[model samples]
Target: MSTTETNSGTAPAQSASALASKNPATGDVISVHAIQSPEEVRAAVERARSAARSWNALGFDGRKQHLLRWVSYLLDHADELSELIHAENGKPVDDAYLELVLAVEHIAWAAKHAKKVLSPKKVAPGLLMANFSAVIEQHPLGVIGVIGPWNYPVYTPMGSIAYALAAGNSVVFKPSEYTTAVGNYLADSFRLANPELREHILTTVNGYGETGAALVTSGVNKIAFTGSTPTGKRIMAAAAESLTPVLLECGGKDAAIVAADADVKAAADAIAFGAMANSGQTCVGVERVYVDKRVSDEFITEIKKIIRDLKPGDAEGASYGPMTMPSQIDIVRSHIEDALEHGGRAVVGGADSVKERYIEPVVIVDADETCSAVVEETFGPTLTIRTVDSADEAIELANASRFGLASTVFSKNHGMEIARRLRAGATSVNSVLGFAAIPALPFGGVGESGIGRIHGEWGLKEFTRPHAIANQRFAIPGMALLSFKRTKMTTSLVKQTMKLLHGRYK
Candidate 1:
């Protein structure tokens, strides 16, 4: 209900004391504002539902105009927005800019591709149903509830948010408590460009667990959630009460495989970014690196050199930023301790590297399979290096996980082949997290990594429902049926036709 303007003039900055947006680098409060009460949350949803009806009525072209406005607004304030994201999330400024660029690209992709992918298509009615013609199309699901994560705060949430909007649905976003300010900024900016859509298009609610739960229970037609596997399960269970459909992008223990034929320097550089960028807080960040024995020594040496060049600080030249969440430091420390206890060797930095708010990158080898560092989601700046016999063995180890969000393969000889073998939502051949930037690719994972997808066609459909219409042509009464004398001949003809159409083949 209240809107404020920041430097970009999107919205006024909320007082950090009231809402509390902290600087990940210094653990200082950036700003804060009022938290929305349950009643206010419901009211927002109501406004969105009302807006959805009119927005949907605008049809394809009308919705596209609104999307373009949002894109323009995002581009106009990208620098200021990126700075805000960096300050709040502790990711490097470049990485923050990258997220903003990709978020804008995704908006463009969703706007341009939604109609083509979701439009009606005619299907053959087959055999006994030959007299009927069928068509299937997507319909808006009304209100969508999005619960986003802090990592890649802009792009991650926008995956669902943009697609939901493209599909003609209103969204009420509840971003991670750690990144609420960014969420508020995005929602407020969207309203500014399309004030006519203020009530219907987008809204933000700030809080922690209870707030997220309330959004899931606010009678939204669908929910799109991105977070840890444990929390994803809880969201699913909560939505079951309302039978609301959900799309979850959960945790991942994603691995980067280095083949014997890989360029060691390139491989090491890729691993460094995949593992240490954003202080290694990405859900799809490289947690483990498996190299062929033939290249193990060389790969480790190369990775260590890159790791040594990295510095953790709050400055521009620093390769790594501070941990966004303070509690994450303890978890990172615990994982390092477990890895050491299990006979792991720290090739670079170690436990003492954890500062008040920043965590330096630590590379460890000889990590036991059962060690928490190897098995759990540290979500910090750390990497475990392991060696295997061949690409097959590398993939085998990589696929052996409860989480399968994303992966990377660095084999010049057979990168795509090996990448295809990993059980993950997206795999980048010779690159890290490259698939995330391609708005055409559907993003999500399988098994414990979570279900459903966001991005591309799948993302658009996730927030909409199928509206099937079958128009009856004319009443066709068989000559035998008109007399109400269903003869054996007519029955025999029907049976014969069914067999001819659907009989099992040899």
Candidate 2:
């Protein structure tokens, strides 16, 4: 652990307690970040709150300009940011670069669409209130606190950060301790793009769980957290103490279903990338595959061929990078071992694939539905394949999990139909993890997969509170709806009108 100070003059002095961000590839420290004290966290939130008054006053146009400038800054230094992400999170340079590209796109989407999505809109006053005109608009929620994850550090946090800012709210971001440098880099860049509003806009707080807890109760209007389900629950509880609302993008056991008429080779290739990319550390990564028994053998053979030469290492040309979190290796090993112990067979790499920082890509077949490998979120380079008699059976098994973040269905004839039946926040038909790249689509999960959404119009609204206004455009003759001077005849007439409009309610 070490400490560093904020470049902004308004930032509080660096604290003695600090945390180290390390390279999972070689177990070397990449950077050290100062852990903000609870008091410091409170101070940052107050600053953001003060800034929000003027920021919200900037309206959509002003905020959009600044956000786009931030986007420009990110693109100009994309290579440097990607390298920082690679060194800190242990993902390959190419993967890190891809994450940044997607993040930049999201920033642009949020900036371009925020005004349209959140602007005030006129609505009908309905028959009962025909004399009144109604309008609804979204108002910024002051400061937003974001707790980000290490896997896809840049992209995941930016999902909330960009949307929050675009919605006209200041943000206080807490990046994962494992990738604190990347988080700081983003905040620093944002300041450089908008130096006048540097202290009032985006700020980064770096540390482990305690620091995150401080942010949770730091009086921010809302908290957006991305991490494990258990951690999400903890954040929810902490925010409860202050009655603060939270948006959780938690864990997932996402599955891919291969229909009888599916393209086996294409499904295999897609599933391989979905499960092995980022070393399968993705919250929406394909952890389970339920294939039609008719195509199970062919599907397995295709996937085996696809990943046969794939390996996980920190070397050039490797299929993927090492596991970002060291302790995750044990979880990966246990899941593989449990699957084997419970009558599963490894069609590709097995428990022996687990190493210090890298677990070779593994594809297990016939894993029991109740086994940890198939049931729990094994955030590693592993996939469990189960054979099902029909698409209905696959849907049943896929929905059996308590988590429902995302799922994919591959079928030429029934792709869309099967996707409709799956219980997930977003489903990809004929493709894998495709919904994530579409900014207009809302992304979030139901049940233990987490709450609320990010991206698109829904994301913009998530960071805003709706305000409705009604104005009387005219007065109805002989009507005294709220007047003490209302007569018995008026009341009788109102009752008759209500019954005429809703007598069917009986």
TM-score of each: 0.94, 0.95
Candidate 1 differs from the real structure by a C-alpha RMSD in angstroms, to one decimal, of: 4.7
The worst-scoring run of ten residues by lDDT in candidate 2 lies at: 1-10
Off by over 4 Å in 2: 1-16, 504-506
Model 1: per-residue Cα lDDT over 57-156, one tens digit each = 8887788899989999999998899999989888878889989999999999999988898889888865555556889989999999988888788999
Please give, for residues 402-457, the per-residue lDDT of candidate 2 as tens digits: 99999999999999998898889999988888989999999999999899999999
Ten contiguous residues minimizing lDDT sum, candidate 1: 1-10
Clash count list over all predictions = 9, 0
Off by over 4 Å in 1: 1-17, 477-487, 502-504
